[model samples]
Target: MKLKSLFVVAFVVLAPATAAKAFPIVRIDAGQLIGRTLDGVDSFKGVPYAGSAAGPMRWRPPQAVRPWRLPRDAGEVGAMCVQPYSPGDPGVGPLPMSEDCLNLNVWTPSERTEPLPVMVWIHGGGYNNGSGTARLYDGANLSRRGVVLVTLNYRLGRLGFFDHPALAAERPEGEPAGNYGLMDMIAALEWVRDNIAAFGGDPEQVTIFGESAGGVAVTQLMVSPRARGLFSKAIVESGMGRQRGVTLAEAEGETLRSTRARGVAWAQDAGVAQTAAALRAAPAAKLLTPAPSIYGGDLVINDGIIVGHDVVTAFEAGEQAPVPLVIGTNSAEFWWIKPGDDTPYGRFDDDMTPEQIDALAQGFGGREGYDAHVISDVIFNEPARHLARMHAKAGLPTFLYRFDVVSEGSTEPHEGATHASERPYVFDNLYSVRWDYERDQRVAKLMAGYWTEFAKFGDPNGEGRLRWPDLRGEVDQLLEFTSDGPVIRAVPNPERLDLVERLYQKAVREGAVAPPAGEVGTPPQRP
Candidate 1:
């Protein structure tokens, strides 16, 4: 993904003061916070979950937030993590940026009987951009569904994922090096577990969900031992499942860029010395280049400790969390996202004959670019099925989805649902995009229902909703959010995805570019 295309998420927080309660206070592990209440939702925006990852703390694990005595005003959105481009390009104006960005936003119903389920949102930017405070992630509607909603900001770009030899050598043994963004997420979840009760949220029922990059993070959290037991349910929207990862200490064979190599290159380009101190001293502004070296395949570095292995490989070994899971892709998932060598097309870029390319392209006969379909299949849908299958094979409750609901609002929306398009529907924030078509509104309500209900009851299905069969209940079954409503159906574009699957297996068996060895064996807590 150019990622600007993917960060294309999943809210604007603007709201009227009509019938609004002025001040609501909540106490957490950090301190007391004063939030504004409007439209039956109490919102605590820019609440710190952990201390800043700025200055010397850069590239390190997130530390506990320093307790505050005074009530902090969490009404304003927090600073976005250091990254390239303002979120949503020109639509949502400039966003705040900072390294002390380990913050989150919360929305809860003003009235609830028992503790409500908690939903922690990890925004998508292909791991390099996007803020949890994006205009599309507003939790007001979802929170009104009797759940506490949380969205967060984590380090992005080199600030988040870079691994350097000097830093690695200097760091203490057993401390996982790369994947700081993932660490930030774990910290946020931990904060939820330790503090959400004060906000009428039951941390035990936490469901972690995201779109695009955020969806990918959901899978990463599943495979990570550090994140074990932190979340009970997981939802991955357009987060391709089959994408592999590079080892913490190893460079990507396809790109000849070890994360450490990328780290070194990043420092050189920023005109800084290669020492750990110099790297740390480098200006944060110069290091904001987002990575797309290989979307899906390039993120969530497989550190031997923090991250055990790639998502597909780990799940194949039954390493993912054995909890209720929801993973799916859109009908035109890659219409905007570009392809890279790490993708199937990129993997076959050099050796694929015209006959081979034609064989793959034959299945996608239409005005829609076959190139986009192939990339979408291999990078999005194919992996989604494989993951759904594996997760279901464990006899765990797993729900898969194919979102193909395109709004007739305007030509401004993609021709198909496309990547990140389903986000508004999930948050029921179609108003953010001026999409008020009845079909669009209906789909948004259905999506928000499925999502919040899943967070509540571990199942998306509820009264009046169509029965979304489990993946194990039927061959390739999934709950598709469409122009109608949630419908139980077979995986979309199966033949294309199957072909891509075969090609992917062939690539692995042929060992053209093998997955990096990450001291793979087994761990005490699954992956």
Candidate 2:
């Protein structure tokens, strides 16, 4: 996939007006930016909040930006969204990408005057490659622990989940044709609910966090009713709520018109012309080559306009987003599981059979812990304990955690705490990763003080830590963290999350999972 070499460098220079009066401006609603204050925070960098998903706004949805009448300057980090560059792709070495990239990045707390509480961040790759300018998502030490950190940039691979019936008959009539990257994360949470109070933040005290595919986009923006009040709280770390997708009638036959008819037969096998303006003026490295494995998977689409269901039937009908949640996972998550490739003991190539890996390792208790418990209980500890037991059975305030710490210079069978190895200890960003610097800054100050104390008060139990309870009755209990600290256990494998919740209700009673284009009713009116 050709296009890599960009990484520009000189991130906005022109200073000296007394070093631009020591940087820090702010005016938002689209004008004066400036930023950069350092240690006591402030920062800013690459601000655009939307507009320019590139040429005919790629797959639509985002929009707003265009304002700037001078001031500008936000020093660095804005290109990244034109995917495919591997070497474990996240920050450093190869990113400064393009296809316009819809920006965002803040940090705040330069001596705050009030407002405060904000969080945001969504970076995990897998929705196809990451970058909220990834240097372990530097939100200056989580905005020096006061709150107001944000970090954005959406739209990725296939330019953020492509779909096409001629691009859904050229969109416009009720827009939404395949998760335009979850509507660019609800337009960056409606630009953090209308400009995070001119940078003091507190846009209704937001929270939304992320980890793996930004923790499956904070459980798909907590069951997205166009992302409800745009965040009151949510965390999600390894992410998954029984991840489902494919629907515009199962992506119009075996998915997105069979990947846009195999990218128009590989753009007429490279002679480049089966039009849509010749596959939008080709050469995005000849339209990102590597296709067939039945056109690789996930272009996230329950598409009833920005996912109106299927987050486990909108959290088993309690319809989600009643905020306050922290979710978890990662105790050897993916510990490099092998034996079979498509995990969960299912698809293992080279014509399998050792009696089919001993009948899929005798229902997962053998082939020596069947690829680390079916790649850590079917992709992330039973979909984060079934979305924290459906947000503690809808009575909200759920907490749950399990990190299990690793990095003592990890290197064994890929050591423990595998997948995302606890993202630089939940963004206190362990001094940009080499590891064990005083035990990763004391587990990044106890996981950024239980994530800014659950974004200030939605409860992570304050003053002199350790309590963290909440996942209600029948002894569910959670919080584990480890490396010799935060403990309070109990709920770890509940019979393998009740056998992967009966294998996701037998793949939703055999239709191999589908029900949720907003449960077959009204959803079409946001052109």
Candidate 3:
């Protein structure tokens, strides 16, 4: 495959007598790209990793970018994939929405003679609404610790994962239908494998990491034969893989008809003909007005090419990529669970009596904490533990964690460590809130140190640091990150995880719930 190249050229302006330091210039497969220096780190942004997915190219697998002659400017972020807008969505970068958003950014140490470990980040917004240029994902802080950090934008929503008979009929020979988003990720990894060395990155030592939906992508990629050998290590944060995937047969007409109908209806509503070409030509804004459901099963499917089987089954069969793993969730991952709403406790038949609520809460310590605990366990925590256990059972070195640090300005009385709260600390970018600056900084340093260390070495623990034992033996242990620092603790509520897993398995057996429908797994959304 012919891929794009990036040639970096750093432009310096100074007096004639003063010799200006040259910036880092690396030649990628596409072309040469010039990256700027920021805080002693060389940064490259808006570098195209694949061809534009606009107009005729939409919904198809990502194509290789046409080689460029001149070095394209790599100083600014590229456009984000078309996605619905949400109020206060911090993950959306300054760039506008476009179909041609298959670009990636890189951050590396300004000076490096030897190839360094690489960490590729996949942003999470429920598979429909995030960009790699999101300020929260700025790789400068992480790169300063001597690793190449990369973040890329992928297809989202219907554009990335829509299935229809017409679409299936149009698929090119040997190309899989659906999962364009995952195909984009695979393409980006292929680009990295062939080109990252020029930027002082060791492609052989790549670590793919992400949180939430991104975490789901990590697990999916791990189980994908197409994604095999693309990454050597994986980190999944709050990603649920217990759900089985719908096979292509299931997605064609069994479970995905409604999703395809939604796409067809949207196309008609937008005044476009119900055809792929017409849909591709439709305005991006029209597509964003009605946000796609995060729970829509079409996003990830067992398409035979990208995902041969459900992740759980693949892992159980030891068919997944054998890579070291670090996976976990926050303590209060599902604080969004509300009273009087359907919950994992088989749902309230009616407005539950206080006594009934209390009874339900008993397994989770009390009513005050019950909803968050149960929901978190079923949706995020337990699934993480299950995946960790699977990796350990397969003899792949596994490290697990539970993030429990409460941010300084949190107003939720019951919030301990909510979803995505650990991101800033992991990136060493604590600009989210101002509560305990010193403590937050310390947490950031500790977390970033652990992550960078993991990228460098398969193990997270290094000399003089807190000892983090790998998950082994009868008793499973997890490193808990708190404001007080890291502490070893037993995986909490093993019985709860077991119960959830059993319930999930029963559902699968009974066909009460369909598995993931595409290459990217979906985190179970609260009903």
Candidate 4:
């Protein structure tokens, strides 16, 4: 069905047209809201999108906001999903942690023409941390680009993603458990579909974009049946699709350990009953503890409900929602290597022999460079290319890119672009991140333009910018952002990607997921 049929946007203007000054009081699907306009942009912060995940709603799909008659305050951001907040975190304010974190923030150009394209940002903190209120994520600058910029928070950690036999048993027969974070994303999109018009947004032209774990979630949304028609375009930065996420149960797939097993074991340690009641009754803090586990942090669970199949599998089988897509990774995401483990060739051990592995190593600049690069290739880089090629082959417009820009105060000796170096520039919030370089502004504008351009039109190409090549007809090229400027170049290492793809396909056929970076085996100490 078309987006027009999907949303019935009826808002009661608090006052008749041409009022002296409206409090910007506009009614939405939920209720009347009052937002403030500043610096040519109107912003509504801490807007409730989903009902509380507290009480009986815990571990279940998000519900609607509890009804309210009065115009609740939309001035400040909502409490962050329960997480440890260090004082040094990005744009973090004094908002306390709570289970009632299903809120979103919207920014709109006060002087824009009617109905703008909406770009909903999903923040990335490895799925364990990050809220929509980070100072760097303030959407004013992007809103100035003539699109509604939305950033939201989803449940995180065990509270966000947990699967247990007991929980499954308690679920209505065939109802999906685990992956509540993904559910929260879908819920937010639904809010946008029905309510974004209140902020002058076009829900029909919505685009979902994210980095790292958020990027991964973007891919999951693309494959989720429930999320299919909610968005029209997608952008994934450093989101890994080739790797397998955990299966809800042993029989689910070949990803990591069954989520059900981990849940049972976690409950047993807490001396809590395996029943859903006992699990839900347990304090939320207990679930937030960070012990080493393969289940959390950018992990996906194939519950056959919310997320039907592996991301790559869905794209390959043509089951994914076909939308204009932009997917890529930074030059060097966080990865490590050690002797003996192939590092996974960092954690994905498979049938490739030493000779074959050596061939792969040479492509990435031989064994030493391979040690540094293979993990990234297997986990982030190659996976991006795989998805782009598949999506393009399906007769959809797909643009692939590599973020090679390095920010100030970067890792010593410059480890290419840090996993998330592009965010500051992507949002055109350089000063917020503490950089004074003039070159960055140009690059930032370029990157931001590419993104907003993609959101406005399904393609990123526009006037006064290098034409971004589409991955439709060819698979060997991509747009790479450099310190000097954005440039399109042949993919860095085709031979390496080829070898990794072959091995990945083999593993998929055999039913196995490569363990996450450092998920298994101790990495050799950083030199």
Would you estimate the TM-scores of all the predictions? Answer: 0.89, 0.36, 0.88, 0.88
Task: Please name the candidate that would achieve the greatest lDDT relative to the true structure.
Answer: 4
lDDT of 3 by residue, 426-469 (tens): 99877744344788888899999989999999888887679887
The collision pairs in model 2 are 156-160, 211-215
Q: Give a tens-digit lDDT track for model 2, residues 375-427.
A: 46766787788778878888888888888887777664555687777888888
lDDT by residue (tens digit), candidate 1, 1-527: 22321222101113213323566777787777767789888999889888988889989999988998655666777778877666353444677688989999999998878999999999887677779887788899999999999999988877887777789889897887778888999999999999999999998999999887788889988999899999999999988766577775555332554667767766777788999888887788777653432252554578756677888888989989988998888887666433333333334344666676666577777324466666667667888898999999988888888888888874634566767788888899888888888989889888888888899989988998888888777769887777976677777777777777777788789863332212111101101
Q: What's the lDDT for all of these models?
A: 0.77, 0.71, 0.76, 0.77
CA RMSD per model (angstroms): 7.6, 19.0, 4.7, 6.0
Collision count of model 2: 2
Tell me how far the alpha carbon of residue 99 in candidate 4 is from the true structure, in angstroms, after superposition. Answer: 0.9
Instruction: List clash counts for every candidate, in order.
Output: 6, 2, 23, 3
Instruction: Kindly give the stretch of ten consecutive residues in candidate 3 with the minimal lDDT sum.
Output: 1-10
